[model samples]
Target: MDPRLFLADLEAKPAALRNLASILTVGDAWAGLPAPVDRVLLLGMGSSRYAAEMAALRLRAAGLDAVAEYASTDASWPPGPRTLVVAISASGTSQETLDAASGYAGSAPLVALTNVPDSPLARVADLVVPMHGGTEEGGVACRTFQHTLVLLLDLAARLSGEPRDVASLARRAADATEDLLARRDEWLPTVADLLDGRHGVYTLAPAERLSSALQSALMVREGPRRPAAGCETGDWSHVDVYLTRTLDYRALLLPGSRYDRPALDWLRSRAATVVAVGADVAEAAAVVRYPGDDDPYVRLLTETLVAELVAARWWAAAF
Candidate 1:
């Protein structure tokens, strides 16, 4: 992907989000589903799957039976009239998702969330909910990824019986994205330096917002071809903590998890560098804050911009 085009794609995030907000205001995107939705099965790959996983977790917390599966999986829930299968692919041409979704085409209601409404995936869907993320031109999934999360959050609200003003949340997310973009000169340099360790970048977030961590790391690797990884904050101590002692560990911390303290203790003890986003932490070498960060929804929707910008910066430099 072209780095300059990627930066341009990121620059358009606020406007794209505002457009999505307006779309949500007009009508419910999922209104076309069949009568009963007893179970939810979300299928996707890459960023689509990342957003779906977070949405599935929220749905389960709301006491609904929901699961996000890799579209490549050989087996999944059986097709049924009461099942709602959401096939998400920004391009609407992910082969695995198309294959998995085809299984439920007639028996279960298939909903396609895609940027290209007329794509092959939409052809099989009973309902086509456009992402409205606009064209990336950059050949990257930045805008589509954010739009996916926002739309999936809306879906979670609908199924959970929770009346969330998703449009308002999208508006706030736009503001936050604009704030970050406007102030990039203030924090990008410091964050880039802090996270530019020899080993690579590590991203950590709470279970609820783990998608942020995963997507952030993916941006670094996808754009810059860098070595990067993501981990859940609580699970860090058990799985990733050992690397800090032997490597020059640098991390982007999305601070919301209650278990953050334990991971911070290890990082501090090992003298690892950290750049906190959306929330201040004691051990962070730098902290990036913006408007609407206090709201968890806003943080979830906006925090990944830090890594994305950093990725863009590094990628541009290399070329």
Candidate 2:
């Protein structure tokens, strides 16, 4: 299937997010825990793990005590009561996630967010949040990752007793996704042109956009068949910046909360080609602006959609 068509199919994300929210809310009701659960544990790997991190932040903002652990790491440790384990896997069959779920002998309830309800993770979960990305090709997760992030944001809101607000925010995110998809033909070609001959790429972002950067790097690797790495903006400023100058690398900056204007200017001064993907572009070599509220979660979803479409365009042009 063509990559554009595959990306267009991501429009089902809103409904998918709503369905997952309903399931989680109903499960919370049915679980009938003496009180709202206080502690939460999230587990996954790769982009799935990145989604867990974003979910942890949203959960924390919503007043729930949440933490994320890579599935491999979580599998090595046992969970305890009063903890809710949320497992995320785009394919629902991630080996590490499945192993973690099976190894978790603790009494805490398990919730799964996945595209396949019948897959291993779902089978072991006490509650399953089904993703709307029906099927994927080329082994790269574009739509699935975006949808999972949206669902997790909604899940966090639901758990925080703000279901209505979460739904509203999701709708806006879905709208932003649609807008980017509509204009993909124009922006993606530019992205493809920018990344044309680069043998390697690096994605930079703050903690909030860390997942976006990771997903962007994965898209470049899987879709464009390029070597890509992602690093936090703050950390990269200290260590990776010198390496980037040494390598004369092209950087894709998914500016997060920690984005320092002076640092970005300095990188530009070093002649690094920095492409900014987000609402406002500052001193970027190229910019792919996504329309949406400034909420990191919402912007992250929009940015991922735009970046994936651009990567898909590159993939199509290459192959």
Candidate 3:
């Protein structure tokens, strides 16, 4: 596997975040822009879909009615003047996103949130908000994901009618992520040793925050050529519990979810291993922690650094 390109994309995140911060500052006033519509539809696919999910959360928290839909399918909503569709794509070339953006252009104004401003999706969008993660040739979205989260926060600031220091928050996100990256040697090997030769790994997160679990599974599968599954906190009981037979599966648990510890206990008896990141859940067989502040939104960005480290380690070992 050619892992250098993937590693380059992952490593570029800190600078990408800093660049986003500089551009999203209070003075820039992008966040100060009035809400074009009270309802929002965010569209993407793969990890870009995950970015849309996070952006929907931020937008909803700021009191907007927002939903994220897979751009691969045709989506519909009640016709209203205060409705907008935002297409998010890292490459800005996804056929699904382009089609969705085009479909929505004549109805509600289409906004393009993408890394490549000149790409096809961008061309169809009535408004363009550059993702500014730079070019990612890794075939996976890494830094672009981070950039999207920061932009979502900037959007939240704008929609809330109370602009925040988005740049400062981005700096904090960069710092927190940097601290985790600094300890790659320590955390990566530990996770690798536990996961080495495992049949597959399961990733768990709250149902409300499925992006964490989805991205975790994506990293392992894309980086290590490993079979991986992502699950919601409650759904794993009915669906994923069947993996308990051989105890060959490991789990990367994103703690702070609703049913984590109880699920962790159940998984410990069944799961080969469970590693907790950010939250210190004692039930986990191993714990890799990062410094996170009070903002749960920032945790969304920083805590993901642990999964990135694990994926990178697996690449090094396999290659």
Q: Which candidate gets the maximum TM-score versus the true structure?
A: 1
Task: Encode model 2's per-residue lDDT on 162-280: one tens digit a residue.
Answer: 64455455566767776766676777777756655455778887887689888888887777677888888887877777765577677777776555575587677787777777746
| Model 3, C-alpha of 246: deviation from truth (Å) | 4.2
Indicate the worst ten consecutive residues by lDDT in candidate 3: 26-35
lDDT of 3 by residue, 245-288 (tens): 66587888876677776677678776457787777777777787
Task: Mark the regions of model 3 whose C-alpha exceeds 4 Å error after superposition.
Answer: 26-36, 78-80, 162-164
Q: Rate the local accuracy (lDDT) of all candidates.
A: 0.95, 0.71, 0.76
Sorted by TM-score (best first), the order is: 1, 3, 2
Q: Pick the candidate with the highest lDDT.
A: 1
Candidate 3: count of backbone clashes, pairs at least 3 residues apart or interchain = 0
Clashing pairs in 3: none
The superposed Cα distance between candidate 3 and the true structure at residue 10, in angstroms, equals: 2.0
- Candidate 1: Cα lDDT at 316: 95
Stretches of model 2 off by over 4 angstroms after superposition = 1-35, 61-63, 74-77, 162-164
- Model 1, 75-169: lDDT tens digits are 99999889999999999999999999888898898999999999999999999999999999888899999999999999999989898999999
Arrange candidates, best lDDT first.
1, 3, 2
Task: Output candidate 2 Cα RMSD.
Answer: 3.3
